[model samples]
Structure formats: C-alpha cells, structure tokens
Target: MANSLPVAVLFGVYLGIVTGIVPALVAWTLGFLFRYVVGVTIPGFGVLVLGISLAGVNGGLLALADPTIVATTDAPTIVTALLVVMMLTLYAHSRGDALGAALPRGAVAWRAIGERTLSVDLAEVFGSEVRIAVEGPVSDIEGFPPLSADTRTAIRETDWRLSADLPIDELQRRLADRIATEFDCAEVSVQIDDRGRASVAAAPELAGVSRRLDAGQRAVSVDALVPTGLVRGDRVTVRTPAETVDGTIVSARSGDPDEPSTAEPVPHSGAATTTGGEGRVTVGVSRADASRLLAVDRAAVIVRSRGRSREIELLSVLRRAGHRVRSVTLGADPPATVADLPGTVLAAETPDGWTITPAADHPLAPDQALFVVGSPETLARLGEVAR
Candidate 1:
C-alpha cells in the first residue's frame, strides 16, 4: 500500500492522522487547569472523543479500499465492511509480536561481534594478516593475558604462529625489544623469513655480564672524554681516591651533550655516577682491575692493552623448545644445573625471590620455592625430577 501510493497523498494522510495529538495535549492542559481553578476533577473526555473520531475516519478509509462486494451500495454494508477490515488489521499486527518472539537466540555470537569488528578494521588497513613466531623467554604478549608456564612451554616447543593485521617490521621490532629489555639477553635476533613470518631469538644468560667484566674490567663513567683516537680495546688507566686500576677499554660513550648529565648511574651493572656534562666517557676494564678502580674517585686517565670481541653467538636454538617459564617448589633431591634438565632452567629460590631476569645459575635449595623456565613436558618432568 505504501509503495503504490502517491508520496504527497501519503504525507497528507500522515499529517491528518497525527493532528489528534494537539487535541489530546490540549485536553490534558485543560484538565490540570480545571482541577486547580474550579476545584473539580476533569475526566479526559476531550482526548477520548478525539481518539474515537480518528478511529472512525481511519476505518472509513480502510473500508473503501477493501474489495468485499455487496448486491447494492448501502450505509449498513459500508459500516459492516469497515468493522471487519479493522478487526483483520488488528489481528495481523498482534501476530507480529509472536513472530519476533519465535526467532532463534544468538547471545554468544552477538557478544563476540565487537571483537570480530576489530579484525575487520585491521583487514581494511593491511592487505593481509601478518604472522609472528616468537621463540624465546617472554612473560607476555601485548594483547594477550600474562602467559602461563604451560603456554610458554608450548610456544617454545613448537613454532607457534600468531596472526595480526599490522605492519610486519613494526610488530617484529616491538616483540624483539620487549624480550630483550625484559629478559636482559646479551643479544637478540629479529628476522623475517621468506614466507613473511617474523621470528625472534634471544640469548638469556646472566653469565654474559661475567664474561664482559672479565675480558676488560674498568666500567666507569668519567668526567673527561677519553681521546677520540683511543678507541675500544686500548688499555687505559682510571684513577680513584684509593688507587689506580689499569685495563683495556671495552666500551666508550661520550655522554650526550644535549642530554644533561644527571647524578645517576648508567643503565648497565656496576655503573658509577659523576657530576656535570663533562662526565662524557665510560670505559670498561677487567674484573681484577675494576676492583681497584672502583674504590677510587674517577680522575683523568691515560691508556695500554688491546681489546677484542668475545665470540658470543647471536642466535641459538631455544633449549626449551620455546616454552614459557614456570615456578615450582624444590624437594629434597633438587636437580643440579649440570644434570642437563631439558627444557628447564632453575631461576631463583624463595629466599632470593623473583627478579626481572631469571637467575638461572643458582642451585636449587631444599624446600625453596623456585622459578623455572622450560617447555610444558620438561617442566612436568622437572616437577617429578626435582622431587
């Protein structure tokens, strides 16, 4: 009826049908005024009269549109036709509620639609989803909950691939940075394979610090820039109040001139602070030499020995098969570090507690709660083995 009708006629009929609203509103206003001024109740006779008149006119129009035939056109026939058409119209409208109620439920899927919309948005931006494969010790992923030991172990043991519709390189760098910064690995490798898969590998070792301290010892922040000509590996002497220690310079950093030097230690371990921007140079020395140099105040130094790079592997197969880290309690016969506990590394004891970097070198003590990293199967084995 709506499609076949003239737009102008339909609009006029709509206006006429809604005109009864004015009289109803006026009736309400008059009723309130009558109650206050005349001190008498005003039953809403005005709106009731408008409602009946509107209904009669609407039925008269519907009756004319009805196709029921009569032997002769008469008032009684028209009145009966209007009543029957109105009844049928009302019955159909009533059934609409039941039809709606009969529809199937979709609570679970409907609730998940919000999450699915995010994937759709990503697809619109990136041509295809980027796949990531992280193979290392990591506590969590950005969008995921804190990883469990079982989850981590499963990841390590297998090439677990996750998909995201984001820039490949950016996602790769973000993962690598988080793992390296959190795990305190000496070196991390981030690469993309031919299949557009981003892979990450980290070398988790507390021993890396020991090796650096041993190879060349003096790690001090100095007030003066060591001569630019004296590069890394040149033997240098740093003077302290107590004594002077001599060692090869493993590294040198001229503190940023723009970034004012505050009285703070450098980020690395065994760091010392000096006042003022003139505190430009940092030098590395041997562990033996560092003992003496650390005792004295850093003063202008002179240099002798040559230094060389330690052959540390950039990437190695994850020993735990890419599993997550877990903590377990130690029983009487705690396994030793030399036992080659596959997929498991004894990190810390209850006495020492947890740390950002796992202290894998320590031996398990009896009844000490321990944090261990490995694949799920290995961790399960360790639980039995440690006991």
Candidate 2:
C-alpha cells in the first residue's frame, strides 16, 4: 500500500531532524570553537567534508540496526540526504561565525579562568574620553637620522597622555610641535591610531651657525662690546674704526671677551637677554661685508629698532585661514618638481641647504625633504605622493 501525503511528509521531517539537524549542530559547534578558541577559520569545503563524514557514520549505524533499510534506499534518497546535510552545514557554520565575532574574546574562559589572566588595560576611560598611556622612548623611522641618547631618555622618562576624542591628524601635528619645542628638534613626525597609540620620529636641531645662514649670507664672529640685553635675530650695526657693517646677530654671549661663550643662542624674539659685558657676537652678513667685518679686532655694537616681524604675521594669518604646514620626505620615486605637488611649496631642503619657495621646475630627488602649506585634504593627497 502507498503511503499518504501527510504520513510521507512526517517521515521526511523525522529523517531530516535525525540526519541533517544532528550533523549540522556538530559542525556549528566545531566552527565556533575554531574561531573563538583556536582563532582560526574553517573553509566551506572543510565543513562539507565534515558533514559527509558524519552522514556516513549515521548511515553505518542505521544499517547495523536494520540491514533491510540500506537495501531499500534509492539513489534519489541518498542524493537528497547529501544535499540537505550540505545546506544545513553551511547555514550553521555561518551562524557560528556571526556568534563568534559578536562575543568578546575569552568569554567562555571566564568559567575556568579568572579575569586576572587577561592582559592589562593600557587605556583609561572617563565619561566621554579615553586616555592612552604612553611609555618608553620615542622611535625613529627607518632611513631617518636618530635622536640623541639624552633626547631618547627624556622622552622615555616623561609621562604622556593622548586623547582619543581629537582628530588624529590635528593631534599628531600638535604633538609633533610640542615635542619639537621641548626637545629642540629640527623635524618631528607623529602618528596616532584609532586606539590612541602613538609613534614618533624626531631629528635633532642642526648644530652651529650653518643651519641659520640664508642664501648669500655668511656667519662671522666679531669681537665687540655687545650691548646689554642683546639677543639673536637682533638687527645691529658694527661700528669699526674704518667703516660700519650692517648685520643680524646670529648668537651673542656676554662675558669676558677672552673666554669662549657657552650660552645657547636664543630664539628670535623682541625680548632681550640680561647678559652684559665684552663678548663675541656671531653675525649673519652678506658675502661682500663678511670680509670687511672679519678684519676688525673690536668694534662698538649698535642695536637697530625694528617693527613687528613679517614672517610671524604671515604665519599667524595662515593659521587663521585654516592652512596647515607639513614636512615630507621624498620617496624613491617622487614627483618631478615643486609644480607637481598638490600644495604650495614653502621650502625644499636638500644636501645643499634649503631653497625657499622653489620655482616650479626645480628638480626633486629621493631623500630630499620639503615643507608644504595647504588645507588638510590637500596635504593628505600631497603626503601620499611624497611617500
């Protein structure tokens, strides 16, 4: 007698639950363990192989219980069983992957292991902000010169806190500026990630008067009774017995004229130092005037009164206009010239020194560095090209 439609449907459902559902559950469990515990992924083919192996085991057990059932099974029934197993296995594996990703790491381990076994947190959370801890010495990028041992030690010893709320690019710029100022670096690069981790690369300030000398200018030391409260970048006239020489003071030290000056050169500012005595002054002067100034043993110094600096005013205006400055090192394959850059080229530093506002056609080379000014987007595009 033929089976009724309802009876056949019930039988098929029972068979599916026994063969398909059971194997699928096993596959899902294995998939979850692979992802969450082993930190590995199982491919679709591997899952299919597993399902087939489980189906064969089920078939063997069923045949052992009733040999007549194996004899009665048809090609179509076997094909249907395999298809159901494959489909269910794939669905279960996918669900397992979703669950694995949703759950936190070691969630299952909490039953057997305690919270103390996990890694310590490096970030502190407060209301709306996260502060990342920064320890150890700052790292230098490959191919760039390393900072001094003292600078490395200083950076390591200081406490640094980085906020995750600020824009990363702006934060990096601010941090780089702070490091440069505090450590007297000529160039500083900072990178911060979404997790509030930071990496820094810094180059020490260039030594001596060479770094400060401009084109067509020479630095010369002159013996004179420098005025009280004199400082670097001061406009002054050296009145010698023969003639007066005009120059800007590169550095000044007020002490005994016969002794060497150990005082560091102060940055460009209107405020004068408290130093007073007969001391030597390093002055930046034109090539023609350099020789005349060198011939004199001693001269009287006259400080020239000047108005507000144009460079400072220009920089302030640029900042107010939402422009930013960035220094980039050229890669092995860089753009042909300053014209190819996306932003305005402020200056290019080569082995021969800096070229201010280089012409469009000026050639570029590997390892050369340049400063560019532009909007954040423009700078971002330029950074990719430079790298």
Candidate 3:
C-alpha cells in the first residue's frame, strides 16, 4: 500500500504539469498582447504570477474532469488536493485583476504629470505668456537643450523679480526668433501677449498669432496750445528719435478729471499749461516713433497731415477660417469685444445656460460659455484670457 501511494502521487504530479503547459503558454501570450495594447510596462513579477495562476486553474480543471488521474482510494487526500488547486487559482486570478486595473491608470497619471512639468518648464525659460505642447516622434522625450551663456545671462537679467534695464519687447522678439530657428518640428505655433510673453507649441493643429498690437503703436500725452485743434479723426505726422510715422489722433480731451467736456485747445497759445492746467492730448504713433517719442525729454509736436478715419482689425481672418469649432467657458471675466481677440472668432456665447449668437459689442459676464472657431493656437490663447 505504501508503494501504491508513492506511485499515485507521482502520477498526479505528472498530470498537473501536463495540464498546466497549455494554459501557461496561453496566459503569457495574452499578457504580452495586453501590455502592448495598454502601452505600459508591466513588471516581471506580474507576468510570472499571472502565468502561474493560469496554470493552477488549468490543473484544477483537468483534475476535476478526470479525477482518476489525481485521486486515490483515500477520499480525504483527494479532496485536499482539489482544494489546494482551487486556492492557488483564486489567489492568482485576484492578483491579475489588480494588475489589470492599476497598470493602465498609472500610465495615464504619469503622462499628465509629464505634460504639466513640461508646460511650466517651457513657460519659465521662454516667457510667462509663452505656452507650448509638443507631440509626434520626439514628443515622448523630455527636457530642453542648454542655451548659450550669453542668452542665459540675458534672460536672468530680465527676470521680473530683479531690477533690470533690458527692453521687454526686444527680449520677446529675440526669444521668438531663436525658438523658430532652433526647433525642428512637423509644425509650430506661437502666441504673444500685450507684455510680449509668448506661447509656443509643436505639431499643433492650429497656428498661433505672432502679431503684436503695440508692435507699431506708441502712446503719447501732449499738453500745448496746439492740442485744441487735434481731433480723434485727424491724421498727424509724429517724428521721434527712433523713426517717424504718420499717425492718427486717437483721443484729445482735457486732462482735468472735473473739467466739463467743452474745454477747447488754444491755437498758438504756445503755453505748456492749459487754462485748466489739465488739458492733455493723447496720440497714437508707430512703435519706432514711440520709442523715440518716449525717450525724449522735450515736448512732441504734431502737424495735421489730413483728416481720415481708419479701422484697425486685431482679429485674424485666415487663422479663424476653416478651424475646428469648440466650446469653452468664458470664465468670471472676459475681454470687452470679440473683435479684440487675434486668433479666434466668437461664434456664440451661452449665458444662463442658454445659447445665443454673440454680438461683437455685447457685454461678457461670468458663467458664460463661448463657442469659438480657430486653430489649437486660438484655443490656447483664449484659454489664457478666460482663466
């Protein structure tokens, strides 16, 4: 009987291995395929446990199907063997369930963290208004190349936290040029703010606007006897140290806060101060003229070239055309006019949870969602404003 027991135990062990081979192969194949589909690296231990668990389940099934292979006359021993097989299968299956849920979620969380880190890094190195998203073949790679020592020094000198004398506009132009030249991308886009901050991206479906509103415009406050004749529609020639530009009178009014609207300019008064001592004229000139005009300690003289009304369009028609339309929340505060935006066109504004065609001059309030059409750049720029 002792010899018979040994022979039976040997046969059961053989049977378990024979049954487990097919299941182990199948389990490994499935795991390999699943890893590729999930796009995440699974640890070696997970694969091992999964293979063993699948093998255990197969062994248990085989024993149940043909009990004669594993069972002897000892009913208690046979039952104990079956239970052990069942326990192994259950434990392995549970572990597999955990891996299936955890692995994919971990991959997604890691990707989000990576994107956020890149956003902050790009913004800091480039400009605060500068935002970037990269994709395609090289997207998976992280970090940027080192800048020249001179470039680094220039950036550090312009840090807003420090007292520095670098010109903001020049820095913006230089950085934008550098990025455009250095980066090799299937596609690239850039956006600039009023303060010359840029947002750049690669492989972007939509292009960002590089146009600057103040690029060619300068503001000047004038106080003189000649200010009285200058009207908003009057064309004027402004000469500054940098360059001369033909500009239009944008606003002409008394500088005094309490003065009545009828304050008139004194022709040839040649006086520095008006009767109210508050009469001031504000003019819009080209940026070149502006730099020179602002630099000088002397007063700016304006001569009427002609009288005309010209419309300035800040929005881009080409960028807005053929763009994928999307809905975005307008946030608590939005800019005054839809026309004020450079890259996007506001199609509709939903307020109070109802949709309506938005008027260009309509007032924007909180809790409003906007439907806009433009490229990815447009969406990005609008997102900054909305936030």
Candidate 4:
C-alpha cells in the first residue's frame, strides 16, 4: 500500500503541473495584467472586483506552488486532473466569459441618464463680461449614459470628487474637446458662464439646443435688437442670470441709449431738403421702433448683406428661424407668434447670445421656433417625432 501511495502521489504532481499549474498560472497572470491596466479608470471598481476574484480562482485551480502536496494527492491520478482542468478551461474559453484568460472582457454597457442643464451667473467669473478659461476633471467625462428623457444628475457618493483649478473658459474648451472624444462626437462645444458653471454639449441639434436652453439659471432680456420688425413692449419672457423671469420688451434699440430720436428725423429748421428746397426721401421707422431707435440714435446700424434686417444678438437666431423656446407649461400649444412668448416662455438677451427657457408643459407647434442670435454652420437635427 505504501508503494502504491508513492505511485499515486507522483501521478498527482504530474497532473497538477501539466493541466492545473500551467493553465491556472496563465489565467491568473492574464487577469492581473488586465486589472492593472483598467482598474484606474473611472467607475471601474465593479470590474476590478470581478477581475481579482477571477484571478484568485485561477490561482487556486493552478496549484502552481506546493508540489509536494499535489504529488501526495496524486492518488486521484494526474491524468484525471489534467483531463478535468483541460475540459474546464476549454469550456470557459468557448463560453466567451473566460475572464481569467483575459480574452473575454466585460463590455461597457450604459444606462441612459436623461440630460439636464443649468445656466450660471457670471458674478464669480466676473462682474462684467470677461473671457475666462475653464478646466474639467479627467475623471468626470462625457461617456455618460445615452440620450434619454430622464433627468441626469451627478452624485459624489461612490467616487472621488472631481474638480480642477483650470480657469472657467479654459476648462470649457478642454471639456469640449474631451467630451468630443469620449462620445466619439466631433461637434462638441464647451461654454463657461461668469458664475463658474460650465457645460459640455453634443448630440443631435434638437437635443443639444434643448439641453442648452434648459440648463441652469441666467439673467436675460428678449427681442434684443434683431431687426426693425421687433419692438419694445413686444412682450417677451426675460431670463436672468439667476432664473427665468417675465419681462416686457424694453427695447431692441441699436446704439447708445443716450441718443435722441428726433435728431435724424428732425431736419434743421429750414433745411433745403424739407423747408426751402427739394424734399429728400427719408425712411423713418415705426412708432414703436422709433421709440427704441431714439435711445441708440448715436450708433450706426449695420445693414445685413442679404436679409433686410439682421439680429445683433444670439436670441434673434432662434427667433429668426422660427424656433421658440419654452419650458413645460400647462398648455398643450406653444405661442402662435413672438408676441405670445412673454406669456409662454422665459427669455433674455446677452452680449454673447440669447438665453431662453420654456414652459415644461408647453407642446411645441410646427410654427414654434428657437431664437438663435448668430448664424450657425451646423443645422439643428430634429427627431422624427418632433419633425
């Protein structure tokens, strides 16, 4: 029996080395290498746990060390152990879940976290308009969930806090670039407000525009001097740097507020054109526009090269294209015209662009429009449903 035991022990060691030790060692090594490379990534803790657990299992199966014990257990026979280990390993590899081998890695699956945005005050960035640089944390990135209808939120519970010392403007640009890469989107844009708030936006135009308007709080005015057609008292919702507020059309006047309105309209007491001599053709604006024109009569108005009127502000773009912005309001319909904006949506004018918010319950009409101030090279992409 003692001699027989010796034979069994030898057989176990042979089995362990040929099947268990070699394959298991290879598996554990592969798993360790994978985690070493990927564990440092953001939100990889779950994967890390899974990888290490798999490595440990491989190590146990391999029995690479302690050959003496393995040889003693050889009574079960090295041949059987080899056959079992080989079958298991081959089976694992075939299933494509062979984590220890590192051939089959977990795929990145994402849950859509609906997009939400915020507008920020510029007080922190600057009391007045000052271009500031923005920086973003590498850890927090744009590989967020898919575009969904749910509200997306950021929480600091499970991961480390992400912050950067980069200036607001620089950070915005950086984030824009980063998010562009993360989402494999080439059209990302980063914007930073005076208040330290930054936004990295990308996606279809409809979604992008919606996200932009809906984000945060800001102070703004409506009908800010697009063309002669827009007038003060036109009634528009004003969105401030802090929140969306209802506002009246103060003026879309161009130029200095101190200028008098009658200067151009009033010819010198007895000018040749009107009094003593031939009359000249003078185009005077309407009563409402004349009122606003009076405030800024000092500055020269630049005529657009193509259109009869041009928007000096960004909100005018949205307004021009017939796209209006409103939060979800109780009504099922949007404003029939810009005149109804004040009653339906919140809006404002900024030197850089226009800020707008819509009523949550408001249903978008085919005629509803978003007021964009400047000309954009890329057109907004709309969904089939919205279209």
Candidate 5:
C-alpha cells in the first residue's frame, strides 16, 4: 500500500538510521585503524560506497521479511539513505586521517607487538677501511701499447706497499712513476682499483745509439783503433793523415758484433789496459765533422778528459724540491705560445728539433709536445685546460 509523503519520508529516515548509520560507523572504524595502525589510508569515498552497499542489502532483507514495514521502496527514499551514509562516512574518515597524522608514528606499537625496527648507519656502511697491496702482475690498459714481459715480471716481483688512505688518483700516479723509473719506460699509464689491483701500460725506453742524438748531431761509423776502456758517451778526437775530427763515442765493439754495448764511463786506473784495438766505433759528431770523420777509412781515437757535470746536480736538487717534468701534446687548435701555458716550458719538441728554454712567444703547432716543469697541482690544472 502507498503511504502519505510525510510518513514515507519519516520511514526512510528511520531506515537510514538503522541500516546506513551502523554500516557507516563500521566503515569509519576500519578507515581509522588502517590509517593509525597500518600507516596506510583508505579513501573516504570507498568507505562511503561500502556503507551504501551494506545499507542496500539490509533494506532488501527487511522488505523480503515483511513488505509493509518499509512503507516505501521508491528511488527517492533509497537515494536519501545513501546520501546520509556517504556524508557521515566522509566526515568520520577525514577526522580519522587528522588524528592519525597528529599522533606519533606506529613504531612503538610495532615494538610492543614483538617486531624489530630496522635502522641503518650510513657512515658505517659507506666509509669502509681501505687496504692497498700489489696482488698480481700488472696488466695493460686499453687503447695503449702493452708493457714488455720483463717489465711486467719485474713489477710483479717487487714489493709494493701503498698507504691505505691514499686517494686512487695519487696511487695511480705514484705507481706509474715507480714503474717508469725502475723499468726505464719511455711512456707509462697506471690504473688501480679499490681491491689493490694495478694495471700498467708502458712503452720501453728506445734502445740503441740513435736515442742519444741531438739536433745537428750525426752518428758515423769509422774503421779505427779506439783507446782501451773507451765506452759510449766518452768525448774523443779522431786523427787521420789529413785532419782531426772531434766526436762522442756512440758505440765501440772490438770485432765481435754480438758483444753487449756499454754506455757507462769506467774510471781509468794505472793498471788499466792502454793498448788500442781495431774495431768499428760509431761516433756522434756535428754534420760537418761527421763528413770529415767518415771520409777516412782508418783513424786513431784519443779520449778527452772531462770534469763533473753541473746539470745532474741541478736535476737532483729540483727533484728533491718536489718539482716534476710532464709532457703535454697539443691538439689541432692549441694554445697560442709557450707563455699561454701554466707551468714553465722547459723545452718544446717540434718538427725541426727540440728547443731548450724556448722563448715565451714561440708558436705552437698541432701534435707538438712541450716539456713543462712545475708542481703536481699546476700540472693537473694544465691538463684540465688542455683537455
């Protein structure tokens, strides 16, 4: 039976209070627990929808049980009940969220429930103690030539001890210097890892008499009787029937071509042998003097006496003062002149030859290299600018 509008409205409000309001309260309780206990949020609209669904089921059950009790099952009555539940659910959920945010975190409750709290110390994790040592034979770096077998073996056999606190870049540099000096390498590149492994790429120093040649110097071999105890780098004067030519002995081997050449100058004592022997002695001399020396088939060599050199002393002093010499190659668009560089230009190697202590304004070309002397900091800055 259809009821009056006032009675129908009253029955709808009562039905909403019994079914919708209770379900809305249950939904609000679930939202509050999720936010405060689990540290997660349940949307107010989700709770509202759930409460409306529960209210529809409750209303359907009430109608099935007794059709006369509901008084009205119209769309307006159902919408009104759903609206009431939605507003109340949304309001309660918002209040729950506010309370959850205002309270302290749920870690205390977790501890009370016998769950462990996870914590990490960043410094302890990242700041590990470093221990550096030479582990095995040094390997080659890519894009560079490999080191000789002898050099690699020597480096591996030697006892290398580095400070555990040294930076990686410093370690690499010191290792490179040590390898270059001990093994007589012309070029060296070093890389080291945190595990104390080293990779070394090196080029052996060029061998033979041509490496010692300077600008305007020529090596000419002549059939001559060299003075006894004569070795490479000794100043000598060759006397022929026509003229006398001054030169430095590059190599002197008596008849035996397989004998090893010696460059170290040996001291002459009173008991030393003085007799001259027939051999082919390669002498480094000026272009004009080389022509004169080469024209003669036979000559007699007289060793010239020399005093101590000051250049070696200067180099030692400079090394003790922490000065270093580093070579840098220029690119296509290089710095204008020697003056534009950071460190002092000791010398510059050009297509022509080497220029010692070149002037400030000397022009630089592509692929030319400059030997600079400075502290490590200056050299590093120069490298950055060059790159």
Candidate 6:
C-alpha cells in the first residue's frame, strides 16, 4: 500500500499542506535572507508575498474542486474528509508508514527546484526537510545560522535547500547585492556539521567587527583562489610578490600548508591610521640577484628573511640513464659496495646485481631508487666487477 493509490493520495494531501507553505516560507525566507544576508534591496518581497497568497488561494480552490465534496451526505463532510485524512495519516504513521519510508531525505538540491514541486513527499521534509535558502541579509534571517564555503559545494538533495557552504552570518552580509542582478538570491544557506549531516538552525548571526577580525586572514586563505596541483617540495617563488618562481620549479611540491602566505611582519612605526600597508622587501640575493627578482611593479615586493637562500636541493633530483660509471650524488665518493654505508653508489648493469659504491656525493635518502645508465660493456663490467 506504500506506493499504491492510497499512499499516493496521502502523499498528495501532505504535499498540499507543505506546498501551501512552500511559497510563503520560501518567499519570506528569501526576502528576509536577501535583506539580511545579501544586504541588497530587491523587489521580490512583494512578489513572494503575492505568490504565496496566490498559491494558498490556488491550493484552496483546487481542494474545493474535489468532486467528493458534492458526493458527501453530511454537511460537515469537507472537514470530515480532512479529519479522516489526518486520522489515516496517524494510523499509517503508527504502522510505520511504508510509503513514507521511500521519501527523499537530507539537504535540498537547489538546481532541482523550479522543475518539480518541492515537498511532495511531506514526511521526507516535514520535520527533517532540506531547506532551500535564498541567501540574504543578517537582518532578514535574524536567527539563522551562518553559511560557509565548505557547506555549499556539498549540497545534494531535491529540496534545493538554498545553500552550500554559505554560513548564516555570511549570507546576511552578502545577500542584497545579489538580488538586483540575478533577480533571485544568488546563493543558498544551509548548516552542516563535521559528519557531513546538514540540518537547519533557527538563525544566522550578524558578523561583528570582532568576528571579521577573528575570521580575517583565514577567510582570505580559505578562498585564496590559488592554482591547483600546488604541492610541497615545489620550487615556489611568489608571482605577485615578484615575477619569478623561487627556485624555478626544479622540484614539484606535494604536501601540507596549502593556504596562501600572509607572512608580512607587522610594523611598529607605521602610521596608526594608515590604510594601505605597503612596503618593500627584497629577497635571496647578493644585491644583483635581488635586482633580478624585482621588476617594475612597486606593488610587488619580495619578502626577505634571514635564511631565504637559493641553491639546488639535491636529496633526490633525477635519475640518469645510459650514462653512468657509478651513482651521482651531492658529493664525490670512494669506490665501495652499494651496501657499505650511507654514501655508497650503486654501479649499473649485470646478472649479479650491481653493488653501491661508497662516494662522498652519494645522496643520503634511503628510498632513492638506483638510477643506472651507460654503454652495455661498461654497465656489465661494473655489475660484474664492482664489489
């Protein structure tokens, strides 16, 4: 009976109650979020109110159009039908409504809206529906939770529940400027937790000065817009600070601290009221290299520090093939077996595996794969003779 006619009718009735609410709740939330979150003035509040009224009127008219009303024997049949529907709902719920088990769950999918009537599966969203929030002003959503970038990209529900990562506080600050352009709130608002579950809070708070400062540089870091595939061990030189890569991409980086650097040392003597904190820093040079790092943009300054030196980092640079006596390394090494110690160089080629030679330049890292390259005779000879 869950997917049967009775269940569908129940679903429709439930839809009626919520569909009756969709426009009003949406309009109010949208308009309210717009004024409060986006902080922009928009004309949709009137349209929302009107649309809600229209939807309610239309829903009521549709309800009245039911032919069963005319077929009823008693005068109270209309209300009686409604009450009976309610009683059946309670009965089904008591029986663990099988149809209700098939309803949608979790966050709303904003893109799905304007296509389907949201909340058709009432129990799916009745107490736990995904909220599609038209983000707006702090004042608009006085009690709603703030939005964040982390939350927005993860939204995946039919409700188009209004937000991804847009924390409540942020929605209020940024909502207004959006309406005039999109004629709709550009973003949505939702609250998410660490386990990836999303649910609604009563309100998003306004951002105060202290909050802004608290969220200051990290917020900028969070949305830094840095190029992808940026990893650790990368030969990074600042493009904005200067036009060159620090070590010119000798090795690609692949590790932690992926945020943009805000390493400018604070000044004690700059004017207290100064707005633009502009200064010059020159890095990695014996004066000549410093000039090389600096180009024309005075706005771009190289950051200097004590150990900001430039040199080839040769822990494990590259493998040499088709050309090798022993092994290449940071320092020269004496001839010895590859198993001798830390600086042993591995000789190339043979049936009997090649042994590493002890050398001064041998790289220190243990995980380095032995690179062998050279003429066949020389390779075979070393493979046979080097011990």
Among all candidates shown, the one with the greatest TM-score: 2
Candidate 2: worst 10 consecutive residues by lDDT? 111-120
Please list the residue runs of candidate 5 whose C-alpha ends up more than 4 Å from where it truly belongs after superposition.
1-189, 193-197, 202-218, 223-234, 252-280, 286-298, 303-309, 321-387
Q: How accurate is candidate 2 locally (lDDT)?
A: 0.72
Q: Judging by lDDT, tell me the better candidate of 2 and 3.
A: 2
lDDT of 6: 0.34
lDDT of model 6 at position 27? 46
Following a full C-alpha superposition, what root-mean-square deviation does model 6 have from the true structure? Answer: 29.5
RMSD of 5: 19.5
RMSD (CA, Å), each prediction: 23.3, 12.3, 17.9, 21.1, 19.5, 29.5
1-387, model 1: which lDDT tens digit per residue?
223234434443443344334433444455444543343544434435544465556545644665432223344434443444333333333343233334322112232233221234332223333435443464443333344464344434433232343234434655566545554444556664434444554554445334555543446655654554455456677766666766655555554667765655334321222322233455676667656655545566676544443322211233323454555666676555423344544445445455433444545567766556655444545534443
lDDT of 5 by residue, 274-299 (tens): 23467778889999988887778888
Best-performing candidate as measured by lDDT: 2
Whole-model Cα lDDT per candidate? 0.46, 0.72, 0.46, 0.36, 0.68, 0.34
> What lDDT would candidate 4 get against the real structure?
0.36
| lDDT (Cα, 0-100) at 259 in candidate 5 | 64
Q: Compose the digit string of candidate 3's lDDT tens values, residues 1-387.
A: 222666655554554456445544554455444553453445555655555566567767776887864544354444344444444444444455455555532233221232212223334444323422221222211233433344333322332220011223333444444444433223433444433344544332122121212365667755533444454545666554555556666555545667455746433221223232335555677665666666654454466654332311223343234344556666665666666553445454543555455566766666566677665434445544453
CA displacement after TM-score superposition, residue 190 of candidate 3 (Å):
16
Question: Each candidate's TM vs. the true structure?
Answer: 0.24, 0.40, 0.26, 0.23, 0.36, 0.16
Across 1-387, the per-residue lDDT of candidate 2 in tens digits comes to: 334555545544445456777679988898887887557778989899988788778877877988866655655556656777788888998888778767754334232222121112544545434554444457775556778786776655545543333455656776787777777677887766655566777887757578777899999888778788886778999888999889998988778757776889655332447378778888899998999988988888899998888988998898778676778888787777788777899999977799999999999888789999987546656544555
Q: Which stretches of candidate 4 lie over 4 Å from their true place?
A: 1-22, 25-76, 97-171, 174-387
Error of 3 at 289 (Å): 15
For model 6, the superposed segments whose C-alpha errors exceed 4 Å read 1-19, 41-49, 68-387
Give the winner by lDDT: 3 or 5.
5
The TM-score of predicted model 2 comes to: 0.40
Q: What lDDT would candidate 5 get against the real structure?
A: 0.68
Find the 10 residues in a row with the least total lDDT in model 1: 104-113
